[model samples]
Target: MSLSKLGITGSEKDYQLWISSAEKKTSYPLTGHEHPYGIKMSCIPATGLLQQQLEGSTSASALQEAFLEGPQELQDQFILKPRHSARNQARKQQGKVSDKKTVRKSSLKNWAFGCISRTREVNEHPCLPPTKTKQLFGAPLEDVCDNDTLPTPILDMLSFINHKGPFTEGIFRKSGSIKSCRALKKKLNCGDTVNLNDVPIFVISSVLKDFLRNIQGSIFSASLYDKWLDVIDQGNDEDKIKATQRLLDQLPRANVVFLRYLFAVLRNIEQHSSSNQMTAYNLSVCITPSMLCLSNSGSSENFTKQISFIQFLIENCLKIFGEDITCLFGETSVSSDNSNITDITDNSEKVAGM
Candidate 1:
């Protein structure tokens, strides 16, 4: 049998874990004379022992054991006092007391080298995990949604502009301060809540000449586009092919809700934009014009009209059966082909996440 079978496979690294463990167990990172791996620690002469074990010895295990058992001279070579001293004395020179511990330059170099080796080994191992960027959601769309959900301009408005009053110097910094989130969250402690199913609708029972004229075939989400067709399929098959002059003219109060909601989100951000993205853009996705119109005209007629319009719109949306219906409250919609009439009458999902 090869002598290697009886010998320790050794290196400074091989000893490191052992040394550190011993230190932790014994409360001292002691090495050499009392170390468990070697044997001649008590018997061999210092100079001869180093040479014999490294290049001259044949009986490896006995040599290692002897090195441990009688390595008396080595004790003084590293210690601050005579060979029999149990600990090193230079430790006091380094201004350490008690279970004094320190890291040396050599130790750090070894640590970095070992880290690099392990990482390289891991890279070579196909089963190892690839490095990744952390995100709240695993999917990129969700990440994008998390990142760019509300536009930057909108968040700035809520945090700064709207909250800023004459007495509010540095309002964003003041209210969005770390402390504010705590106070606000405490006041708004979360509880399971029934979502409000309130949405004012706008019923346009006419040929949307106004919208067909204004929108230039820009909308692309296939599901939403399908829902738009279903909405058009609406209002009395008896009301089909009816005439209108312009796009906004045929649209319900879409523009009004976009403007108001934009303003509300802005108020939360504390920025006042005389012109908001949704509010300022006369051209928006098809829903924009209808929602805007419902919000603009004032009077009980408007409120009654708004409620009737939302109900009608929701009804048409049920025919399409989609998540876009939830978009009325800025929530993500689900995929369904035919929604139930009672589904929308409940309106629970409509108010969720608000």
Candidate 2:
């Protein structure tokens, strides 16, 4: 058979040599009637072109490029086969899975780091020990003093502010020097006698706020927080006042005494609103957060009501707390103090009489 018929450009001697080498390297039959490797003889031109490039360059890269640049039929027969397509799809899926795992790990790492950072911050600036806090700042009113009287530090600070802070502009609204406040706190915590008169008016005000803020259960008590908010939602001022009075009657005697004293002081300050610019409303706004254990989920409307409730307390201090000679520092027992008490006193008496 002529070598040219097989698409070989070489002499018969070269074709014989090529055929001998192919027979040794491959298991394909080389009969002239059929193409080796089961391909059709008519498609030999594309395969023949790839073979020619491989013969010209003995490099494996050139051989691969030849197959890649060959005709579509040749490419489909070799590189684009079903098995290769499946393998490529598997690799792409694996890469996507790896990417998602990497992203999840990164997010988890960031979350862990954030939690650790917050923990460190808390450790670095931890709150005072419970015993120390109770000693220096607050305890339950009943636990600390007799006759529903204020804690010593609280009473001292309030009395000083009452005497010197009423006419001070922005009494509770303004912040004092942080350094001074801390120093005063340190002194108080150490059981050192702190003369409020020697401290700045703003500092004394700030210390009082700090005291209330650090109190164990807050002045109003957490159990009563929702009820206090509900008091503001009452239909009218009359109903609201009555609700507030009932709530006040529910307080532990110590809280009632402290509340009465604190509101009396706030009312006194509000009376000097012309000079201080801290009206009952403003005082309420300034004092609410410290006095109440605020809820994070509470809406702005609830906050407004909280402020309004506080404002009402300040505006009607005597009516809500009643007028007891022993409300502040009096040593009279709860039973004996009832006679001088007014609206709230009447309700408490009714409850007792019941």
Candidate 3:
């Protein structure tokens, strides 16, 4: 029942793994965890959604109908499965089993294939849209994996940090820009208690880390970033094609294809920076180090080049995930052992002006 036992006081590494795995729909048991009924250990759900998809109920066309007609609560309950898992499960249920051993082998093969597809989907389209071209998958926007849109406030803050923005020159004008908390509160139309940390910086940081991890296969690997940086530096036709092929091999086809177009747009932005009254270098620097954890370099120039691609990533994310990307932030209330982890969004209905 202790906080330490629940992993609140665990080593920073363990805490991060626990969190990242949770995002991937993997379970981690919290020993000595307290439930409302009594003192007991608890395991996280095997799937991100609390409920399972009903038989023949989660198809793209079906999901779209449900989204249009179903209640918000119902929408929240629906779970989207990877295409590979769905196909394999269908095959297993339909195929004839010759023997117990054969069935076991089939199951093992299906599991392995399913895992490969799952990893591919995550790495390629960590923020894929519910619908591809004509059908919808009914994915929920509450979870970071399923959700793609950056919150307006977070976008504002990022713009603030970068100086130049997707839309504006940001909160700071020129260089030295400081305002009192009171002045900021009034300007931003926030309460006295609101601070920079009050924004969901942690959640945004976590999402960025997850995205990078999926693409690179491991956040600890410097080689992946270095290779990417090399591509940026070289910028030759042959090198670009080779790098594009490599990424397409690793990522989802849709993502790879979309990114091609995205990069085109970014290139145009860089080329016509003078028209927009902002230099390409300045524009790039404002968005680098996509997340705090991925801050691998101290050089602004290098970070600037790296950030150009991520800008497209974030903008594309908005298209994939839809607009609502509300995440929980702030303190937890722990009056009892049975208490659930509190997110500020839990009370969103009651909290006005959020």
Segments of candidate 1 deviating more than 4 angstroms? 1-127, 134-221, 236-354
The CA root-mean-square deviation of candidate 3, after full C-alpha superposition on the true structure, stands at 24.3
Note the clash tally of each candidate.
59, 0, 0
Full-model lDDT for every candidate: 0.29, 0.60, 0.33
How far residue 171's Cα lies from its native spot in candidate 2, in Å, is 0.3
Give lDDT for model 3.
Answer: 0.33
Give per-residue CA lDDT, model 2, range 234-351, as digits (tens): 8988898899888877877767766766786787778778878899999999998888746563688777888888998888777776755223432322222312322221112221
Q: Assess every candidate by TM-score.
A: 0.20, 0.53, 0.26
Q: What TM-score, to 2 decimals, does candidate 2 have? A: 0.53
Residue-level lDDT tens digits of model 1 in 1-354? 112332555443333221212122221233443433433333324446446545666576665554443234331221111222223433433353333333322233332112111111223235656766432111222221332243222222222222222123222122233353333323222212211122100111011212212222221122233333343445763242131112223222323222233333223222221222222121122233333232234466444443443333333332322324333333322222212112212222222233
Ranking of all predicted structures according to TM-score, beginning with the best and ending with the worst: 2, 3, 1
User: Who wins the lDDT comparison?
Assistant: 2
**RMSD for each of the candidates:** 21.9, 24.5, 24.3
Count clashing residue pairs in model 2: 0
* Tens digit of per-residue lDDT, candidate 3, span 132-230: 331111112122121233223323333222222222222111222123422442433331333454433333223322233343323213445566555
